[model samples]
Target: MMASQRGDVSAVRALFVSQRASPYDVTPSNCGPLRFAIESGSLELVQFLCHNGADVNTTFGTFETSPLEWAYKTRQIEIARFFLRQGARLDYLCFRGWTPVVLLFQESSPTVPLEFFGLLSGHSFSDFDVQDRFGVTALHRAARWGSVGDVHALLQLGASPTLTDNEQRWTAAFWAASANNVATLKRLTEGAPSNFIDHVDFRGWSILHVAIEAGGLETMCLVLELGVDPHQTIMVESEDSCVMEELTATEFARTKGQATYRCFTQALQLTGYNISVIEDSDTELVFWDT
Candidate 1:
């Protein structure tokens, strides 16, 4: 393990060849030399370990990830590709619904390379929409991180922007709004019509509502321009009962502060909305509508 972590390929080879060590030898943590080699970022050591019969699919660490996943998490694209070529499962979901495709977007820098997506796709099952345990697809991950290029690549690779995560059913637009990433949101809604920008999450929060809650004044204005009503409300349902709470966009803005409220009101006027109707105290609603 030490020699592998340090990229001492000859020592590793000698150990295996002299029968003094098993290529499968693992630490108390179940981590083998291949995992170390991947962490070391040495492709030569990785190749040597694999040639000497290291398990490409070995699951280790807290996430119980495969060697390919470690390579990805460590940003070793070449090593990851080598594992894929050695028959690592691209669709394999480790802890938290992480697959090679999801990892490529989630762990990669915003400066995504086209070749990375292409490589993963070539080895994948053509299911770009595969979600993790949390139901987060490649699109959701990319959009949440504001990686526009990754979003484009995933969409071109057949990933659906409408797919939601398991926890909140957050769509690509929803995730972008949650992160206050107007750039990603614009890219996502480029060809989308006005109605398409009105997409809501599991809580019934529209993109405008989410943007306001995210405290992005610019994004709020952008959504209004895209045609989301300023008076839009998000319905929150409690698990204990069937009762629902309607939280208006204005209310969300007000809670943010006087400045946010001013921005919200101004955005409404700029979009040609009747600001008075939204501000009417009689229209005020509580968390519990009962």
Candidate 2:
């Protein structure tokens, strides 16, 4: 383990030959020697360990993270590809119920090459829309953090942007909007169903509502321009079950306080709403003229 962590191939080989250590030896924390080799970024050492009997698919840690997941987490694309070629399973769920594909997107740098996903083609798995335990898919992760090229590659590979997660039932477009990733949002919604942008979560919060709550002024304006109704209403249930309050997007923003209220008002104005602003000693008022 020490030699592998240091990436000393000669010392590791010597230990193996002298029967001093085995490739399957793991740390007290359940991390294997191959994990150290991969973290050391020594592909040669990794190849040697695997060739000498280290299991390429060996999982370590409480999450049951596979060797391929380690490579992806460490941004070792070549090592990851090697593991995949060695029959690394993409379907293995980690502690978070995240598959290898979701991990790839979640852990990879934003600059990861588009070709990175192309390697999955050699693998037998085709369900790119598979979700994690949280019901978040690879596409959702990509939309939040990946480059446009990454999203394009996933789409080509069969990841569905329309799929929603378990918590919020938010599709990739909603995730992109919440992250203020307008470009990714546009790319995801392109050629989508007519009602795609109009989708509301379980709470009846639209993409515009999500943008406002996330403090993304630009995203709010973009969604409005994209045709989300600014005056769309959602029913908010009060503590009294018999009393329900109807709130519009602008009204929802008001409850978030002054800064958010100002932002939403500006977004409405920018999108061509004839809003009149009035200031009083105690409160600010806005009137939308139809």
Candidate 3:
């Protein structure tokens, strides 16, 4: 395992030959030799292990991640492609319901090959909307990270923007709302049905509410222009640590906006007005006084 982890192809080969070590043995660490080789980013060692009957589909750790997932996590594009050619499942779920595609987007680096994404997209079993244990899909991950390109790619691969995660039932739009990612939200809304953007969480926090509290005035304006109701309200609990309060989106925005700046009130008024009035105005509106 140490040899493989160190990318020591020759040493691994020598140890394997001398000890008759089986590459298929899953160690107590929940990581197999092939998975270790993958973590080393050594293409040669990985190929050798696979040739020696290393199970590319073997899952380990709490996430049940396969070698293909390890490849994606390690940015081992060639190894990833090799595993795919060897019949690795495209939508294999790892820890927390994360598929390789979902995990790929979770990577902090941006240099991953487009071909890899394309390969996963081309796979017949690639379930674009496959959710994690949290019910968060690739779209949710991409939206949370502000990964616009990956969000677009996932959508093109037939990922549904309407699907929501388990707990909050927050759609991709809602994820974008929480993250204040207007560009990603716009991409998601493109060609969507007129009413598609009108959803809220299980708590009844409207898209307008989310946009206003987490997003700035521009985002609030965008959501309203996209046809969200500014008058939307949800009954939220805990006014005095135990009481419930029903607040309109406008009022909620004002309350939340006060913590950051005084300008959120203006945002509420702009959207809270009759939609007809906003549409009729030719003058540009400023949300804040600089």
lDDT values for all models: 0.75, 0.83, 0.74
TM-score of each model, paired residue for residue? 0.81, 0.91, 0.84
Answer with 1 or 3, whichever has the higher TM-score.
3
**Cα lDDT, model 2, residue 31:** 88
lDDT of 2 by residue, 1-290 (tens): 88999999999999999999989888888988899999999999999999999988889987878898788777788898888878788777678777666766663366566555666666666768878788999899989887777787888888888899999999998888888888788788777898886789998988888888877788888888889888788877654566789987777787777898899999888989899989878877778887
- Candidate 2 Cα outliers beyond 4 Å, as residue runs: 235-245
The runs of at least 3 residues in candidate 3 whose Cα sits more than 4 Å from the true structure, single-residue gaps closed, are 107-112, 215-217, 261-263, 266-290
Please name the candidate that would achieve the greatest lDDT relative to the true structure. Answer: 2
The full ranking of all candidates by lDDT, starting with the best, is 2, 1, 3
What's the distance in Å from true for residue 121, model 3?
A: 2.9
lDDT of 1 at 54: 83
Clashes of each: 4, 0, 3
Model 3 TM-score on a 0 to 1 scale = 0.84
lDDT of 1 by residue, 68-177 (tens): 77776677889978888898876677887677666665533655667777777666558778777678787887887837777777777877777777787678888888
Sort all candidates by TM-score, best to worst: 2, 3, 1
